[model samples]
Target chain A: MPLSTQSQAEEEQYVLVANLDNARNLSNILKAIGFKDHAIFTATPNGLKVTVEDSKCVQANAFIQADIFQKFTIKEDLVALQVNLTVLLDCLNIFGGSTVAGISTALRMCYRGYGYPLTLFLEEGGVVTVCKINTEEPEEPIDFDFCSSNVTNKVILQSESLKEAFSELDMTSEVLQITMSPSQPYFRLSTFGNSGSAHYDYSKDSDMMELFRCNETQTNRYKMSLLKPSTKALALSCKVSVRTDSRGFLSLQYLVRNDDGQICFVEFFCCPDVEVDEDL
Target chain B: MQCVVTGGNVKVLAKAVHSLSRIGDELYVEPQEDGLALRSVNSSRSAYACFLFAPLFFSRYSIDRGLDFRCKLAVKSVQTVFRSVATLEKTVEKCHVELDKAKDRLTFTLHCKHGLLKTHNLSYQDTESLQAVFDKDSCANVFRAQSRVLVETVVHFPPSVEEVTVAVSSERMWVRNHVEDEAERSKALLTELCLAADEFDHFAVGAPNSITFCLKELRGLLVFAESTGLPVSVYFHEPGSPVVFSVTDSVLEGNFVLATLSDDHNLQKSDSGGGHAEPPPPPPDDFMNDDIDSYLIAMDTSVVPGPSTAPPSAASRASPAADSRTRKHSEEEEEEERDGNEDPGRPPSKKFRSLFFGSVLPPSPQTSTQPVTTQEVLASDSEDEDE
Candidate 1:
């Protein structure tokens, strides 16, 4: 049947508006609500054209209810997490199809609208040099929470080269630590655990618990604290999920360990040209 | 730099079979250039021979006078054999001079009693894009000749001969003069190929031109024949075995040697018969240079016995016997004495020696006109290996 003629009773169209970085996450959430394999196309400006099966028409609207948006908080451990430019540089340095041409092409196609005046720090021969984003400037700097409280979060290996990468980390049987200040945070993580490491101890006395909005429900306030990881414990394997907070910050939350383990987060904001719904 | 005479001067090497009857009814010419072409000619009707028409005048010291460069391109016989000789008949006489220097040229046409036979154009280029090599400064001169001649050649059948001894010769003077050194050239080629050949088995691909295993198999067959002096007949059914060359009717008839060749070689057989079939593209000629040199090592064990058959003329038999007896007796005596002197740990029996020595039939003194000289032996072995 031609899609246009299909009755709203038969199928529904969902317009998903989010930063492209969170496209896959929203897609999955929509899928879980019976919106399986919807025909998805790039939306005009900053939206995704999603066509749901008639069966999912009810489930999708209910899943994207206003309350879910209220529950969402794009949380970044804004202070604890730092955008170590080296990780992006290292990711870029990988040869093969990963040449500068590929990076530049990817930047032009994917990164241009997201940000600009994007300060890049490069270390060459042990000297730190700064690079400014050459293409159009990003509408605003990336918004992140920069809270450094979570001291013990799981190290994740989420790439095709995961096993090989972590074998190189040699992080097992060792106390891990990480420290970050609120001024700048949000590490543009490498696909694998291959690139960076962090270790820290979360003292019981420190502000150990904080409520963070998880995108799924307003009542789903994610609490954060840290526990000392057993040196004898092998690193836990985990999956990642991206959620937008009430404040409209896109946080990459590692839904990591199955039982609501620590959430290591990064925050990204949509391009300013994207007009947020005034009603929110 | 002082010029030293290489101490060896150009000598008449192999003589051309004077008449077509003296050679095979069909002679296959393999030029390094355009693969191989077998030309069929009527032996009784056409007189065939190459004459060296050059160096018409010779000074004991330097440049010879009256030398016919055109005649030097001629084919001739090395022996006073009784046969029909091709004679140069009609000549296009022309001479030119540039700045008072002599440039002489001649064209001769030949005729045979019967009709025309095939002539091959075998020029090849050294480059991938094969173009003729040219001396840009030299004037373009054309020397055209009709190739045919008649001679009443008599076949003097030796009394005890079981097979006809057809005389054959190379058209190229270069091949003739260097036949003795052919093995050396082949050997050098083989050495460079050893590693590549040895590693052939490691490659996943089927054998196309596997240098190593091919050499080993050829060597094995040759060694078996040489060890026993009994002709080694083989029926190779293996798909990978190279069975492109055949020398004796015995090998061809005794077994399925034809079946042993790669499918391509069989295709070549049919292609060979079709007169219009273009020559099979040759393996790179330079490649042959390397292959031949390395293969020369096997030459000692594999030279095909030349035109030797049962019946022998008294004179023809005499010289070969004298040469073989002198050479063989000395070599055997030395080998025997050395056996005694060798350490006991050395393989005590000569059985192993038979593996190599016996397969190579000592040149049959009674029938073979030429002595199996070391050089000739090496050349034959190399050729067999190369093929």
Candidate 2:
């Protein structure tokens, strides 16, 4: 139709373009890391990374590889811009976000370099809506600098097992204490709530645990409020990788598979609430 | 009063309590030998819901020695305890409800399998009974339709629609969103649905009638009706009367009373005028077109138990043609005054006073001094003045 022809003619002026047959593929992942309003979008030839941070202590990143998109094109080496993630998601799913099979909203996202609004064209059935959301100067996202080599302890477990414990975690607790060791009490999640202290232990040899590598015992406490938003990613993921570095910086990596079975990754990095006394 | 409910019956009770909680914060529970009655009225007094569960619906029903056991409990407390009825249906063996009259608290004890018991004590307040008495024979129109059809049709209308106008005649019954904004009216695109007389289980119309009522409350009542998988019976006298929606199965009967909107005919008239020319003259004797004094009387008698004593004053005041004409003229003047105060392109101001009163004008003067019959003379007076 005329709309398709017009989009083709208008696509040449943009530095970056991405298209998805199902807009939910993008909206769902954005919702996973949607802990804050402003999201710093950094796009490269490899893929797209959306970063959201809270209080500079917790940072979340959602990675969508280039192959996941039906069509991904970039004329520049790097493109970065910041926009309201909530509004962007709302615009992406403007067609009521129906999950019925055989019905999907097609999306064509275009960004014209510097000072221009991030333009999105969403169409379902025959109706088309074009939304131009104003972009802001991208803020520098905090670098948690949590490297695998510096990781002192790591464990990968099935998301289903952790989901049960997360769902029942007492919110009255100020902090969630994680203890990983080579000896007994192998992996533990402890919460001291108003009612009482609760400990959820997972044996290192359990079927749900995929990998467990601990050289020495490590105990770290993370603010419950900071780690609460990661539950969204956990709920959508099939497996999760929990890692703690020497400095006690915690990282949670979730492997999420969308409706089409295409794989994506969402990572959350949270700073420890307190430095543990080694004597304990 | 003490009762035990189990299985699917508890789920139904929970749904009813949840629906009543939407109407009012406080729910009045009245237990009688026949059954139990749950009633609530909205704070605005614009909407009311009454649910009656027959004794057969409960597994074991008993009442303390008294005329009737009545108490008011906070709706939120009840709703929280019964939030997940589906879970209760599977896990709960039986639920026993007891009214501790001495302590002024109602206790609910739930017994589950494996000897698990949970009890919730809900404090209640001392409140007067809620009684809405309306003569069913006085209603001129009655129709019964499947709840599914009504709910599916209402879904087509936009969410902004506050009121819906239902027009029923011998031929067919149709509903249309009552849009009051001039700008929205200009679009000429409205959600309208019509159902043939055959679609209704029973359709009887003494006279062609049109009524307007709030759509939000109707939607809520329709949800309750659909949950029961029963047809809804609607009864109304005329335009400015309370529209009653009744749903009844073998075990339960629910009646939802919503006050029809006044001055809705004015909205239709102005809409048809296409925003050009002044509104057509108000219907001469439509009780709503009367002076504020008589209008208040008409409103008051519809709710309170004073229909016999209140109508004489309305009839006497409505007798003088000169006074009625002046009042009608002044009402029109006041409407224009309101119109002038609003933004030019805005639709006519809403009849907030009439809406707040929720008064239904008695259909005929023979029923209540035949107050409307005098409007014919008043119409002629205004026509002469116009010439």
Mark the regions of model 2 whose C-alpha exceeds 4 Å error after superposition.
Answer: A1-280, B67-69, B85-93, B109-118, B181-184, B263-387
lDDT of 2 by residue, B1-387 (tens): 889988778878878888787676678787866789898765444567889999999999988754445666767777755755556677567878888777666877666443334455666654334544343445678989899888888898877787787877786877887766677686856777888899889999875656677777677677777777889999976654567888899989888877665444535643442222222243444345444332221222122221123332332222123543343333433442344235353223234222222222223223222223341221211111111
Per-residue error for A160 in candidate 2, Å, reads 11
Off by over 4 Å in 1: A1-116, A135-237, A240-280, B1-387
Measured by lDDT, the strongest candidate is 2
TM-score, each model?
0.15, 0.49
**lDDT for model 2:** 0.72
Span of ten consecutive residues with least summed lDDT in model 1 chain A: A223-232
Q: Write down the C-alpha DockQ for each prediction.
A: 0.00, 0.02
Quality of model 1 by C-alpha lDDT:
0.20
User: Residue B133 lDDT in model 1?
Assistant: 13
